[model samples]
Target: MTTSPALDGPLTTALVGTRRFFTRSQVSDDKRSIHTEGGRSGDAFYRDRWSHDKVVRSTHGVNCTGSCSWKVYVKDGIITWEAQQTDYPSTGADRPEYEPRGCPRGAAFSWYTYSPTRVRYPYVRGVLLEMFREAKAALGGDPVLAWASIVQDPDKARRYKSARGKGGLVRSSWDEVVEIIAAAHVYTVKRWGPDRIAGFSPIPAMSPVSYASGARFLELVGAPMLSFYDWYADLPNASPQMFGDQTDVPESGDWWDAGYLIMWGSNVPMTRTPDAHWMTEARYRGQKVVAVSPDYAENVKFADEWVAAAPGTDGALAMAMGHVILKEFFVDSQVDFFTQYNQQYTDLPFLVALEDAGDVADTAEGADGPAYRPGKYLVAGDLDIAQAASENAMWKPAVLDARTGDVAIPNGSIGFRYGDEGWGKWNLDLEDIDPVLTLHGLDAGGTASETARVVMPRFDAYDGKVAHVMRGVPVRRIGGRLVTTVLDLMLAQYGVARPGMPGTWPADYEDPSTPATPAWQEEITNVPAEQVVRLAREWAQNAIDTGGRGMILMGAGTNHWFHSDQIYRAMLVLTTITGC
Candidate 1:
């Protein structure tokens, strides 16, 4: 056989010369070797290089969310492979050392670039039929046989549902299944009233469309939707009562500037991740941290002091601390401010005495007389020792009529009366009147006369211990009392009361017994008693010492309890007591 010149070169020599005598099968076998090595195959070298480039691309790793470069290899004007170049920046620009270009997943672009399974071009069914003639021939007589067998028995097709043979099963279309589900939904909605129809599937997996549909259905149907907790029976009713809404504590930012931070039943360092940062910063700045809880926690780690308390005794503890603050002159400096701003403090002693003296009326200006109401005011007296000395420089005994509510000021001293009715009835010696009755009034509602009677006597007596007991009695009688009894003691012990100061009575009486304690106990929380007391004391002291700049941070741990609302109320009372 003659050799062709085209096959004699290094690129094609294997196809020429003696290879010309080889049979077609031999030629095919030898051609496979060209891909291995030392073969006269230009295509093989190009393919090998292309394959190597592809491997490099697959192995190249990239960092996520940072700059990275991609290298592309081309042969004969065709992109053969691509890989990430970690040595260079992805953006082809300078980047910070911390910035990483492309993640590992992004670097493996070959899977997406050279995938054979990817649809390169759209294929119509007609084109597939023309291209797959050999496949059609392979299917052969099976399809025809199936059609012929079906045609042979119309009765068998009609009775397919009841058929039992191997090929007797009938295939139903997807439309039928969809129709069945649609019908079931309609039926359920009609039968159960929309509220009873649980739109979610039994399985937990849900599609966005399905979730939107369910939400829309409930909204349109005006159904009483139950929260996920209700469905699981883990929903708690205590939150609303304890915090006043869903959470305890107001949305005010006043606590941030507090000189002293009081934490009760709360583990802020562990639970309130974001807020803890600020707390730590505050601590570094010399802010005092006091923690009160039944159990010690990480939050206590940062606290200057931690009080371990018994559970369900928070209220009693608060009262005890109120006793201490009032009797010990611990909160004397802030007593004037508290009495002015806090209705509970203003009404105490005075209101109780009036109630005891049977001088208050229930209706406004009715046949009975002027009705006593709870009062709220702001302290306007000088809080410093010098201010007290200047104000009390001269002292005189003055008596105000109980029925007329008028104060009789001696010539050298100023006589003071609150509201339009004036001081109803005041004795120079307030000790003669029962403190509790005078403050609460005869109608059992609190009046200014009652508060004046009770408070003046305690102030005159200057005994914090007696003031503490008397304060607790009125608060115990009226449930939602917003004032702290400790404040009264603080005022009496500190001698913050001045005869002509701006202290005034509030027009409303807070029932301290009904909505305050029992509700706190039953609806708001179940805090340990010792912790509550500790918190009250810490708060009172902080408020007194900090000049009403005490901050309290109540976290989820404390507010999550059964009596959280009461806890908040107690905290509020403490704040009010110190005029914080």
Candidate 2:
């Protein structure tokens, strides 16, 4: 076919066939050869040129809240097709293998590069732009004077505010945008503290360089940076309760290694498309999975069991499971494997000294009532302990010694390491040390007159089965008072009632009214009581069979709670108990 006449070139209708033109059919000016020496179709060559002219390595850095390297095929500097890059250097054999990561949000991003809605230049309200230009002229081209005139006058600022959301944004030059922005910042800072001029964007995980640029500038200007993770409530703040950590979870490849897997509110198939293959393959390898969530979550499709727990009741179910494991495995059988695990890794045996809160009816004017999270801890101040600091010796934890009357600091406890060398390490070893016994004891007589009970942090399913409030725990205590273990307090807070303990002291686990028993959990969670108890045992047994190979992959649905820390603590309880 003859090449079409060019619209912009110096060609007119009059010269359509008058000259021997340089068209696709004829390239020579002499017109001796109308076609190329080879008569083969020329469309293939041009198609190849347009399809694969050049390719540059780049990535889809758009809506994913992140980016991944992609091989972008380009023709004449225009992007055509892109695919996941495979050349990233693998780190190690153990870590999860990653693909050039992307989400469905990326598919539309290439189109958005040149979309009509793309913000190609700085923008301001049309009225504001005109007003600013008028101000500049009126102020004799002095930008600072123009800015002050526009912003200082209430009418000038109000005019733009009234036009907002009215689709009147005008393209603004970079200089004008920067000038106005700087003036606004100056005005804000002069009137208010730098902290008031806070900047917020997504946290660095999605785009570190972009985030860092804003952060660095804010830091220089003494302006506060609002943490996006905290503001958006994405942080797993419960991580620190055990030993501060995140995202160090095993890779998808490691899923095949699991004997039992729990997907706790993590929508793996949807959110983790790259890792979904591993999950499917893991099922093929015969690894069992338990999906725990409220709304029949996406990952439940892969699970052997789907425990549809009620909303916000995961903690209650978890606590009930903990009760089963602790009661069946630890208390009933005293399984050496689990007992040793607790003795080493957990704060299970840490001591909590009991303080009696006089009946709530007898509340005095200034006296503080019952407190679950104690501020201070009980210490043997008279024992002249060498490890205890002279100023704040009470903060040291007192573990039971083999000696009848003496207490010692367990080798791995926060108390033993506090104000000492190598204090930061979270090693689980309790060698050459004794854990405080989990039995009730009474300090009958002491200079500090009030009788104190040695308290363990077991949950009392019954709110007040006995006259004493077993559910109440002191968060902190001052010197010359009682102390408690973190585990003991946490358990009590969860209401894991231990039967056959003392005079009706613990709740009857079979009773649904008891807060953390499977029956009670069933009421709140809507998960059957049998499922909770069975899953707890099955999970524990699986961990034991596989040498602590059970895992739970969780995400933001549970992390965004006001009581997220409690949820994390409950998970910590189950994982620590199962040695997972």
Candidate 3:
């Protein structure tokens, strides 16, 4: 037979021959090329893979919580740099403003990423080898390198079985490492209970899910809570006393609505940002700003007046100012309103008189004496009855001395006692009378009079004369003094004989013979005498003023001090007395 021309040489030879020689040759050639390419391509792929792996691996050591973006750098098939990705969020061609990508510590991300001290592999020593041998023998297996054994019998034995079980060192595979960690967590939870398993983190940056889980777990386990500020002493001490709750201050809204602002011991600008902003706004709005502090602060700069008084002496300053305000007629029109509506000012005179007469027990009487006990009111001596009263007449009985039944006699008593060698005996008989009548209750004209008055003929009077004390005097002090002197002069000059008016004085007066001793003054504050007196006078004037408001703004700088609570309380007193 004749073979086809197309297949004559190779096909005919292949049909006649036993083996397919041309097919074998083609296969061989293809195999050779593939083998050659595999070596080169494999190396290149592995190199790239290893470089990418290193970059990812380095990220494990970074203490970041995704709050910032980052960049990675690789060189010679290894990660070399990692840094805050300031250029991230780039708008392709158009660059946006560079925003900081990390916290202060994140700036050093590169240093940690490229640290030479980082361990790349599990290390094993002779002791580890011995432990591996022992484990293999115990498991009825031929002794093998620990790392290899872990990979071979992952399901049968722990990758770190030797180290974990017997506290022996052993090399482990990645899978084994993960398994070991999981098992440990499970074992701990099972063995020690959730209480002992507080949390697991090498850093403070916790994921939200993790934090929630941990927090819930801790609450369930009855774990002791970690406090935010362990260094605050006043919070610990005053919280329970003031709020009856374990917190420093209640979440009260802005106090800027006050017609008068009094800042006692608070420096708004240095410490508090929001309040400082409000104070600035208040000043811009022409709201009267009063600062009562020992230190001249940024708040003082905005103050209409500043009272640099002795620290801790604020209570005295406040009481004195109240006295002055009552004596003067400045706020006389509002006295009844305050007595009936505001618990703080309602029975202040009576309370002070009680204190003066030693009528207040060690426990002291409430604002509405004979009704509530001391400490029942939020303020020291303030009672709800005082606030709930319909008129000053309703609260007048509480102000009188119940023991001797002696009350203040209004116009019947002169300003000063005269011709009284044996006056003590006669006064004793008068003290025995009913206090309502003796002290002078509501009379024909619906006015109350001083039972027995002691007038100061040399009293300083400033009527219709607008005198501006330095901005350094506290508004409360100024208000108090102005309220007392101005009101008194106005009443005396205008002949308005109203009971709770400017001309009326508090029944209780400070004994000039018993001024604060030097030792007592030094114990309370570090202010000079002259400054203390001046501030006291100004605060007094402010307290009684009719056409003013008092406002107080506390800032962080003032609050962060060791004596912040005391300072704040003092300021509160100053403001309260000034009717701010």
lDDT, candidate 3, 470-576, per-residue tens: 00000011111111111222222222233433222223232322113222233345444444445544544544454324444443334445555554444444444
- Prediction 2 TM-score vs. true: 0.70
Off by over 4 Å in 2: 1-69, 87-109, 112-184, 247-250, 353-373, 377-383, 389-398, 402-405, 410-428, 440-469, 472-480, 499-510
Runs of candidate 3 with Cα error greater than 4 angstroms are 1-231, 235-259, 293-296, 304-334, 343-548, 555-567, 577-579
Give the winner by lDDT: 1 or 3. 1
TM-score of every model versus the real structure: 0.35, 0.70, 0.33
Instruction: Give the Cα-based TM-score of candidate 3 against the true structure.
Output: 0.33
Per-residue alpha-carbon lDDT of candidate 1 for residues 1-580, written as tens digits (9 for 90 to 100): 3335455466665543335365322333334322122444657765764653332232332211122455666555445656555564232223122122344444445556667866555332332222223232454623333323332446533444244343432333455334334443454456565665554321112244554666666667655544432332212333443223443443323434677877765576554432455566567767788876767788888888876545544543443444445433332233545544443222233311123313332211221222222233111121222222333322322222244432222221222222322244222334332222122222333322223223222211224332211121122222222221333433432223322212322111111222122222222235443454455566666666777887666544444435544545545545555666
Give the least accurate 10-residue stretch of model 1, judged by summed lDDT. Answer: 506-515
Each model's lDDT comes to 0.41, 0.63, 0.39
- Indicate which candidate wins on lDDT: 2
Tell me the tens digit of each residue's lDDT in model 2 across 127-161. 98898789888988876677778778999889888
